[model samples]
Target: MRCVLIISKMQEMSNVLLIIQASLMGVSLTLFFALVLSSLQKTDTTKSYEIVRWLLAFAMLLFAVHYIMQMVFGFRAQGDDVGAVINILFYSPIAYILSYSILRIGCGNNYYRKFRIMSITGTVLISCTFVGGYLYYGSMHMKGALYIMGLLYFFSIVLFIIYPMKEIRRIRKMVDEESGQEPVLFNMYMRTCTKLLWISALCIAFSIFYTPLLVIIGPFFFIALVFYIVCFLALGYNIRQMSNIIVAETEDEVNADGVEAGTVAVKVVMSEERKEMTKALIEGWIKNQGYASSEINSTLLATRLNIPKRQLVQYLREVEGKTFRIWLSDLRLEEAKRLIIEHPEYSTETVAESCGFSRSLLQVKFKEATGFTTNEWRDNHARKS
Candidate 1:
């Protein structure tokens, strides 16, 4: 009787967890759609954002359907087969859309038609095979069908892995062509997307074996649900960041010439003489005053130089082989070193403030750039003097 009560209680808890998971997913989906809609309305040239928004919306919808089906018919003997089939059908499409979205975002918009056809063909093939096999062999003898579906699923995972590699290669080529440099943010973004893809592939592989375990142990579903929700949230955040980057790039192009008109003169590339002059001016300003201000940033520096921030960023990348942040950090580190060595009386807090670095950040950057703490540098220099 006690065991029966415990079992009932466990089942109740499982249902509650499942409902919470579903609600979270639904809310996240709605919020993501709302954000995408807002971006679409506000931005005129968000092709990449549009593709990502729709793909994510579709993926979220499929997830909702899968969860609903699992909740409704997952435990029933007569309905379990149908539920499993529906889940399987939804899984491949969701995976394919997400993989394709990542690819599109990473690779740019060159081969849309080819990718569209491939996506449609793959979806049709997988769906038809699963449905046809179920009808012919029935659920009891559907191992061959499942195997075929699994093989196709694995193929999609392969594409997911392959596309990211292609994206990395594309980025490398771009860096090579554009002055042998890439922005730090660009590199970080690519690495993050690659990591997300690898994780998604692993999750999909785990799900295939996880479903059976879920029947014997209901709590496992809760763990899986949490994992899936967290993954989706992380992916959604990445998509949002990507959308912002696209919007910024579009704005940069539109405002490159300091003209607000819909059409403007083509921007002439900055010549070597001009590049050297700009670099010298920027360096002089930083050395004299900019590094001491805590509020200094790319925009502020650009304003000082009377150039668009994007142009400044490009100049820094092409001429200096560093991002604005890296350039700023180098200046700050130089100032910090001087302060610690030549003016050892100033407290670390004062040095950090005067050098435009926060207290914790000073510690980190000082150690990273000089291989010594602030005090260590000061003591070493004091001994030398």
Candidate 2:
């Protein structure tokens, strides 16, 4: 009687777990689909914004499809391998989409050819490894096949992360140095990368580490957690900031027939002649102490120069090869150095005002640029009055 009772108890538990699994998938499907619609409705004003937005939508759609598949195709028992197969198919692509989006934002189309080649090669190899191993042994649930899949995915994730990071760093350094713009801060990006790493680790664990007690329950909960987290990120990450991540193009890439990148919306190219004219105008403005004005910004500068705001921004990035803030800051820094050394009698407050820097900010920027604090630099260069 005890043996029969034990069997009956186990059967009841199994049924309850299955219901939970189904409920989880159903919830996931609904949530992901709603995210898809929300992403679609959002405005994508720039090319980079458009690409990332659509990719985000597509990735969510894939998640929705994945959950649908889990519910439809034998949502697994302890011995079943259907859920594993679904994960490999959808999870890898999700990682790819995310990594690729960042790559494009950082480097533009320069790395597109190489990225495409890698995508094709990786996909083929992973597919073949998973399919061939299953066919050879006629057992989809084989540990060897799943481990191989996980290993491939793990390595591939690492490779993309490393490669994209390199390109992003390189481009950021070059563009900032040339254009006087600050480099795109990777704080948020690093957080996203951390999430991607977690996803990869989970993929590997899900493949090889399974207990009979929590078979279906594990995958269901995993799917819900990851899917919801992704939805939040996709919906929450400020899309406007993406436009701020300017990717530089080479001479060959920026020429006629080449795509213009890193603009808010304006396609009006700053021709060399116009850029020179603007430079002359700006130099004259500088001579008149235009930068010393505390309340100036790119918009005001554009208005002052009689150029469109869009054109002015392009001019700064392309011709000036620096950001407006950097350019202005450098001008002020030079004035501060001059005041501190040549006009050493000037008060710190007077110097800061003349150079358009707050006493505090002058010190901060001076430290960053010259690796010495304002007082330290002044002490080293201080003249006998």
Best by TM-score: 2
Per-model C-alpha lDDT, please? 0.62, 0.63
Where is the poorest 10-residue window by lDDT in model 2?
Answer: 177-186
Per-residue lDDT of model 1, residues 166-205, tens digit only = 6556544433332211234444544555565566455544
lDDT, residue 79, candidate 1 = 36
Across 121-146, the per-residue lDDT of candidate 2 in tens digits comes to 77667788878887987866756777
Instruction: Judge candidate 2 against the unseen true structure and give its global Cα lDDT, from 0 to 1.
Output: 0.63
C-alpha lDDT of candidate 1 relative to the true structure? 0.62
> Candidate 1 has which clashing residue pairs, if any?
none
The total of clashing pairs for model 1 equals 0
